[model samples]
Target: MKSSAITCNNGSFFNVFDEGMSLVCDEDLQALAIAVIQTEMKAVAKLADRIDRQFVQACHLLLDCKGRVVVTGMGKSGHIAGKIAATLASTGTPAFFVHPGEASHGDLGMITRQDVVLALSNSGETEEILTILPIIKRLGVPLIAMTGNAESALAKLASVHIDVAVEQEACPLGLAPTSSTTAALVMGDALAVSLLQSKGFTRDDFALSHPGGSLGKRLLLQVSDIMHRDAEVPMVDDSVLVSKALLEMTGKKMGMTAVVDEGRRVMGIFTDGDLRRMLEKNLDVHATRVATVMTRPCTVIASDILAAEAMQIMEAKKINALLVVDENRHLLGALNMHDLLRAGIV
Candidate 1:
């Protein structure tokens, strides 16, 4: 024993108990996870091909719905159903989530005669969901069941059954709801998006529902609503000196001024950038007329156009400010990029 020599590698662990944890790092384990994902993706793809008359019928039912779509489910199915309901509600269709458990405990009052109940359950026999079925039926509301089992108790009771059955579970044990839940979620999205397209839901309509988001700012903000009117608008007569135009730009804090003729029509625009270019040429600001230094045929737009459209115009013309004018070329207002940003139009 005293003469024995031993050497160990740096990569090998000393604790025997810790070696078992290597299963988490095993390549076979990783391959299994990848296989599960690929299988689920294929399932989703096959489901896409199955969108036949049943899918169209579902869309039609939702399109004709005069009231909100009441979505309900149990367990993991409930989570996916909640997201589907939100997507439908935000995209032209009125909808809300109703937990089946709560529905049995007096939340059933939320459902109306005009409403359609879309129930979700992988097994289609969730006790909580089944308990609310009679109440939904008594309320004279139709049910749309989404489940894997076509012969499920819930499916048998539904007016229209949309099968979201998957070939198998992605879970190795086949206990966890994986592929089945994914199929149901994707199917729900398909329904919501199809209804959204059928309704021809415009960006403005979406904006109205999401005014707190950036898209709402882009679509809802109008030129007249955000432009600087009256004293804030920088303007100078054509005969005014270039120095006076610069002063107007400074005082108005717009970095530009409208050069107007005697008829009150916008003849040209003078900007801080233009003033810098003029100075590089050693041009006499004191003697030169504002009209001589201004950029003619300035970019103009109607005050009623959306601010998002205004941003596009500014980008297209390679300019920062716009002269808001009426049909007669009468200066009505003016605004720059900064104004749009302040109004959350950016």
Candidate 2:
């Protein structure tokens, strides 16, 4: 009759009942964990077999829709329906979710003749959904239903039905929505991605939808947008003394400077790291030309390449800062890791 005692060890918490009856007793916990994972995995595996012509028809319907996709559900299905709508909207398909109960009130006005309806219900007999079924049909809107019960009223009435039946629930009592919900969510992702690819949705398109986030910066920011421009670009004639190059590097504070010929084309680069090696070889900074000590044929990026790509090249080449060059190798600007960090592309 005593309350369970909870304790933390090695970053995990465990519960102890009277007489050391552990809530997370190793054997029981392992069995429960494996059962949950296996149950959900099996549910997803079942979907593989269900992906026949119905799946293709559903995708085609969504792809060809001239207007937005309207999604609706009740309770737990409502939560999953919202996520599906969001995925579709963010991936080039316009979609929005409306609660079925609200639809009975006045939200039904949101649906237009050009819109498609998607409904979710595990039992496929949700009263709120069924109440509005006649109206949706009379309006001639194409209805797609995701449900476990093929015989349920909602499924039978839908233009296309997707089976999300799971053999069992991950919940020990078999009443909680565990495996069924996971299956529905996965199916939503499958539909969204397929539609995205069919429409040729590119990364740039996704970035436009998510312009306020870091992902947008990674996809939309080019080297030209963040690189040091005009006089801020570190450059020196190739014939300049290595000592003079060091002065330019220090003044610019980018730890490097581009070595350019008379035509202002990049010939090489000199960095603090190069200075260290030059000192080791007893090269006279005063007497040595920047060309003799510079790292020639250095890494360069086009001004138009994504800043994210520039970060990749810098990481791979084991260097910071790159000369921004034209297709013909004329120096346009310069960039370094700090620029990427500041631009939120790091």
Candidate 3:
């Protein structure tokens, strides 16, 4: 095996394998990885300069779109376009990816005059994308082009062209779509986020689009949505024996019971923790009233509050359960740590 020393940008020397080299050391591999990252970083950083008037026009076109933003690209650009479309849609912009090839097929119907077209082609000369340009123009929809070459046909024909041209590819061979694709993706994010802010998109709005995941559960799930309600809520009269309150807690499996008055207004709460303390004092459950040992002014939440907020309150208070009540102190429901966990909010 033979290797030669090469000077890195940091003025440090590292080994590079010779012609017959069949294996490389960790240091050489790390150096190559670092170079790739540095190249991509520079490419992304250059995009900051491209966020000029044309970028704003592209965003305005997308914002004013009455229908969905139709994104199209070819090959690797298509994959990035799909991701960009998803991000835009999830961020409150109605958008979907249409492959350039498919758009030339019957899928071109997906693009309407009300929609805005966003086309991605690194060389600005993807044959598939260029094939659909005439039809897109005939539809009279705004076309936003992302390409590397400003003089390319796609850029010249576009309503607005945003340059995603990179100085070089991260690939040593310089033929692969490495840094260029990243620049396009970042530029897409810039457009999507700008549109999101312009539309005043909120977390609740995002939750509507993502209702099936844990994120939806955190943002959309409320205290009332998962609380034990009606007959499921464990409750006992303040006049009841601690032993009877224990039975209510056990039957409901909530580990706690709200002690209410004759009017069904909550006075306090008794939990398994209280039972442990009662036993330490040798207090007889059957002889003692629940109100005598219950915690006064226990933590309570309203039904309209988010379940995530409830979790925060519970964690901060170091308590495992909360009583849901009306503004008039009327008991409505109950919940515990187990309930949050069951709802995937914990």
Candidate 4:
């Protein structure tokens, strides 16, 4: 038993020493990683070379489509197809993913002649997908094929073929759909982005599609939609004592109040910031007038302005709240940065 233990220890020692002394240790693995990435990139780069009449025709068909872009695939291609559909849908191209299996079972009814079908298959032949090729052709809906095998049956049947062929798979066995799927995904992203640029998709347009997301809030939310309005606004006349304004401010819990004139136009703004400066000057809060300590030319914004733009202005001016005013400069509402934060517009 002792001899066996010594042999085992020697074996481990030799193994460690051999690995430490090896000059190419882990270098081959790094090279392989780089090679895989290069292969995927080269595949995508070939798209420019392949951009002939077929690509232009495909773009034209999609541009003229009045209905949704139906994207379908199988296995790993299906996952990529779903993402492509989502990207297209968000980028002005109305699209949805339909499982090829489900399409054969009656979901094909969701497709229309006005719509264009984007099919993904690395081999250009997925049995479930091919099974519906005839039906799609019969429906007279245009087929845009995204595949590696341009000579395959599906490609032959396609109205336009986009070759997303990769040199090889990243998998050592070259059996898993590694590089092929990556090529397909990159091609899909390229298509979506191209369509997006062609459509002149503005931020406002993107916001409309993403109303529940942060991007929508940034573009669609207006200051008037969130600010405290009318009776909810805390304000006082210049003649009012600082104590009176403080009471209004405290009651309203805005940490400040606007000082207005006889015309109901904002004359100045009083806030905790002003209070800090007042305390430093040893001024008596009760004896002071609202105008004495208020900040003049208080940053004001129109109610029609986007909340995100308002946030930018407030941040750039180093202020927290903005007095919302009308065209005639009458105080309409009040908004603090927190208001935007709560509304998810910040």
Q: Which candidate is the best by lDDT?
A: 3
The runs of at least 3 residues in candidate 4 whose Cα sits more than 4 Å from the true structure, single-residue gaps closed, are 1-35
lDDT of 1 by residue, 22-43 (tens): 2232445568989899989987
Clashes of each: 0, 0, 0, 0
Cα lDDT of model 4 overall? 0.88
TM-score, candidate 4, is: 0.88
Give all candidates' CA lDDT scores.
Answer: 0.88, 0.92, 0.93, 0.88
For candidate 2, give the lDDT.
0.92
Over 52-169, each residue of candidate 2 has an lDDT whose tens digit, in order, gives 7888899989998999999988998999999999999999999999999999999999999899999999999999999999999999999999999999998899999999998899
Q: Please write out the lDDT profile of model 3 over residues 70-140, one tens digit for every residue.
A: 99999889999999999999999999999899888889998999999999999999999999999999999
Among residues 3 or more apart in sequence or in different chains, the pairs in candidate 4 whose N, CA or C atoms overlap within 3 Å are: none
Poorest 10 consecutive residues by lDDT, candidate 3: 19-28
Of 1 and 3, the candidate ahead on lDDT is 3
Cα displacement (Å) at residue 122, model 3: 0.9
Query: Of 1 and 3, which scores higher on TM-score?
Result: 3
Best by TM-score: 3
Q: What shift in Å separates residue 221 of candidate 2 from its native position after superposition?
A: 1.3
- lDDT accuracy of residue 182 in candidate 1: 93
Error of 2 at 321 (Å): 1.3
Residue 163, candidate 1: alpha-carbon lDDT: 89
